[model samples]
Target: MVMAFRKKPTSVIRTKASKPKTPTNWLHLIKPMLMFLCLLFAYVMYSNWSSWLALLDKTPIRAYALTHKTQFTTNSDIRDLLSKEPVLKGYFGQDIQEIKDKFLEIPWIKDVAVRKVYPDRISLTLVEHRPTAIWNQTRFVSAQGVVFDLPKERFNADGLPELYGPDSEAKKVLEAWYKIQKDLESRNLVLKSVAMDIRGSWTITLNNHVELRLGRGDWLPKIDRFVTIFPEIEIPDGKRLSYVDLRYEHGAAVGFISQ
Candidate 1:
């Protein structure tokens, strides 16, 4: 039975095929890490630069120079001003705008330009106010109608025409003065001073020491009449005209100087 028996058919075992192992791309793996390192290095450099700048700011200003546009302001004045603020910050760290504002606070300075130079130096360009007339007793007025005052010793107001008025009316008074002066010149009269009282009353002092009183009415007409009649007015020998009152409607009242 064993010799002639057919062998049972054996089932074949099949194994799955293995996939190929691909090599890793080294460049792709290292690129992101390299980028991160570069970014970190740049940040560190920027931080160091900021720290250097901060340290430089702590260094004090070593030298300062001023350029004056006019002789109205003196070097001593500028030095005195600087002396008050002895410890100006470093040139690179200074607040230029703040320095300009402080310079403008000086009565004689009208405009100021501040600059920081290298190696701890600062330069200032100063434009001073030119006095065109004496405003009241303590102030000065410029041709541009700027009113300012400096120390009494810094300026000489001897020859300047004295102007008096409310602070708010400075520009108006200055404009009126120019017109009045031109009109008065045609009559051979020189205007020495002008004043406006709180009541808005106007008065002018001539070079010959005569005063003209122009009230709050229409002063233009009054001024015209005076200019027309001024040349014809007679003065006695050894006596000058003292004052002319122009507040009237038609004509003005003239008074002679008593001998």
Candidate 2:
């Protein structure tokens, strides 16, 4: 065997070449996926909540609960007026403006404020017209110079001044009356009534039963002139001043009560 046994050839095994693997970061992908799922869940919840709220708004139980919880307080006249209206209609469907219009239809209501409280209530505030004087014995003149009428039994007109004039001349007559009243008040005189006849002639009755006739043109100057000379006029001892006619150009005609 030591003699050269013809060296036997050894066979080498062959293997396939493998490619390099790239590392994958699962944390980044998982973070974005979790964020997307959370967003989707939140959107679904919000949509459901919105739908529930809308349904609640139209529910009859909600409207009934609000109706029972509503509170209203006003004068008897306003209350009576409100009683004629369909005020208890479905609360959610009730028109606030319609309520306000109904309130304004009342003759005495000047302005109305309506408010709706959340989840169940309504509030109303009413401003009533204040009558300053009686107009033509049928209507009333408000402090803002508006003419309106109401039930005679609703208000006391005992001490108010009686202002008579054509319907178109109400404001003018009121202004003149106010001016004359202010002027006469400076002389310790009280005006009981003011009247403007169909001929546009002005007349005033005093608290002392004295009547003053002021013809149409430039009566203010005559009134001023009379105010200036009133204190200087002298009456007979047994007589009292009864009437004054200021229709003259320069002077007034005075009448006296016979004792």
Candidate 3:
């Protein structure tokens, strides 16, 4: 399913964020230290050729300390990704950006930070994603408007609105839902779902099993008209509200069904 970021800085975005919880990635925590020690060896080798051969066994890579808030990403997920990296010792102090670019390949990873330390060590920091809503019934969007996909079972989709729209219009569709939701609340209506068809028309289902055909092009005004007229609608005995066609230039056509 799709996920959106929530409450993350512009530089870091999204997850429920369906974020990572633990394991293997902590190796990434140690990867920098190893990189630093390896680079230090390379530098010493170049300067004095004699000391390089003496202390080759003391790998700077120490034990790792892992930190994660969720379990959306697993140990194997990270292990498999890191296995593909060219041995870190191959290039003299391996290109920092290149190391970062490699891990960024994981779908769940939002960003990676790399730097060199004073005593021949490397440091890597992995950024986490925060998920806000599910999109197109399959992906999630972050608070920062980032759209990415994750499996349905990986997150808690209990209360998020199922928003449907063209991939390019994800942000627009999400924003529209928020406005519609606020209008719905003022009416004390519970929203079941919101869908925006390929042509950009909008439809919403309510908890009462009533449908609102909001029509095409910006439905907020149409919904406002609905809020005003809804309470005044008369059921005319033994009938229940079925739908309201709100596409009119003025007013709306209300439909009813036999109860």
Candidate 4:
């Protein structure tokens, strides 16, 4: 006998429908509001700028206090010097940089400290340059080899040796003078002046008023040779040492002043 089984009904499938996604609102980026704060701050500063300036103007500087560690810059001198500046023009609106530049214009001033004394005063502290020599008979040289002009006339040589050179060669001249001076002083000789001519030839004058011509090249060796022979060299009792030309390769030729 043939037997056939009947199929059971298929089970139904079911699932819940998914909700649609909404588009992102990019305008909501102001949630932290940082950009808004920046805009507000800029607006306030722009609107109140002139008012702040006026307020600062009302508090004009009435007095000045100056402190300095220097011999040439006295409190009174600084007072008289800076009084002419517009530093006291307005409390904060006036040019502080201009005042500083004016202070630096003084040949002796090396550095400066500036501050405002709250209610009515401007205060400054200064450092002065240590002068090494006088340059070209008109300007002063600092120990660091900078050349600057003095505001007042220095008629007195003040015993500082004079250095002469082209404006661009001041530092080179100073270095040469220092080295030459040290070597001469080692031999108990006084170096009074050192000069570099336009042709780049160098000459040094001793305290005895004798000049040494070390022309156009390395001069230290020539200086050494001269100082070595200086003490024992025999000079006629009546003739004074005038000049020694060290330009030659083999030896130096001594010269005497015309009788």
Candidate 5:
């Protein structure tokens, strides 16, 4: 009977697998978190607003005014008001950024900063532009070439070279002329005038009206060679040399004054 009896067929059941969670659907979990954060932020803002308003209501305006004619006593009064406990407010009447912008607009002020103290006082720092030289006949030029003008009585530049030329050429000519003057100093000679031709050629006149023509190429070597030969040349009696042409490759030519 046991051999004849077959085991009952087991019931077979297939169950569907659960789907994998995608990050896109999981984003719903952050909604509650964001709502909580927003509520907390609102509460904090309300608290700070109430505190600031109460402090401002008690602050004194007359004492905080910044006026040029006011005596030092007024400033002391303001300072005393600001030093009170629980951080009295409304002393900084203007926004710090606005105050900084206003100060920067001043002619001499290059930069400025404003800081709020714990109570009511403000701290200020300023940077002024340093005058380097006079630009043209009126404006002052800083070391960085920023031009501004002040009353002549306010500044002085007795020894700075007076530069005159077209606006486009002034800077270039000034730099070139300065270099030429420096080179002249090595020979114990001082240049009187370094005038540029219409074509931008450089012509230098010495103290004695002895002119030199230095054509476009680097003129230092020519100047050096000419300096070596200058002392050797002897001018004819009653004939003063007018111009020395140093543009030639090998030798310098001198134009003599007609006797």
Candidate 6:
């Protein structure tokens, strides 16, 4: 027997939706918006740059101010110093940095720190350099090698050995002199001038112009050996030696200038 199949009926629904495309010119609106944004960004950057430039102009003066520290000091003197220069004033408008630079130019000022204290004022703190020693009769040399005007009162530096020769040898000569001074003090010997030749040879002078020559080689060993042998013998009468040379390995030598 043959089997047969039948198809099922289906229902259809309709919806209304009809609108003609209104010629859209979206590019026109977008182009204007992008241009406006670019112009705004440029203006912002320019304004920020101008503000920074203004700040820089005044930095020198603002830097000169004293910190909000001890009331014993005031900014009047600082303001006077800054106001004297019209060029500097024109460079700094409400800026304290230019003032600071001027203040730093003062010979006595060692260091300065500047701060922006908001609202209406700036603070400046100053550190003045203390004189270490008199340099070559006319100038003053600080512990850090900064040369300045000679102070009125002579500063008596404790145990600082006199420096001579070129500026290049200052550090080395100072160190060696101090070391030798300390050593001599321990041994009850008062050290005076520590002179070094251009060839780096060292000579020590004591009271009454007594010279002790330490030659080119290892000086500490030579000095040690001299110290050991120094006390043993007595010099012949009326023949005082001018200097003791410890350069030789076997023994020491003496120098005397005959008048």
Best by TM-score: 1
Ranking by TM-score: 1, 4, 3, 2, 6, 5
Per-candidate TM-score against the hidden true structure: 0.72, 0.59, 0.62, 0.70, 0.45, 0.58
Q: Model 2 Cα displacement at 177 (Å)?
A: 2.3
Residue-pair clashes per candidate? 0, 0, 28, 0, 0, 21
Q: Report the C-alpha lDDT of model 6 over 134-187, residue by residue, as the tens digit.
A: 444455556775656634553455554555545566556666767887877767
Question: In candidate 6, residue 30 scores what lDDT?
Answer: 100
Candidate 5 — what's its lDDT?
0.63
Q: In candidate 1, what are the lDDT values of residues 10-82, reduced to their tens digit?
A: 9866555555567999999899999999999999878786455656775766677876455766767666666
lDDT per residue as tens, model 3, 52-156: 433543443222223444356666665565456464432233456766777677665688776644334556566756667787677887666567877778788
Best candidate, lDDT-wise?
1
Candidates 1 and 2 compared by TM-score, better number: 1
TM value for model 3: 0.62
Task: Flag the better candidate by lDDT, 1 or 4.
Answer: 1
lDDT of 6: 0.64
lDDT of 2 by residue, 52-160 (tens): 4545554221221112211122345445655564643334555678768887887767887776655555677667778888998988987776788877876789999
Candidate lDDT scores, in order, read: 0.80, 0.74, 0.72, 0.78, 0.63, 0.64
Residue 147 accuracy (lDDT) in model 5 = 58
Q: Clash pairs of candidate 4?
A: none
Off by over 4 Å in 4: 1-41, 44-53, 74-77, 80-87, 90-95, 151-157, 186-188, 224-239
Name the TM-score of candidate 6: 0.58
Native-vs-model 2 lDDT? 0.74
Candidate 3 displacement at residue 199 in angstroms: 3.3
lDDT of 6 at 45: 76
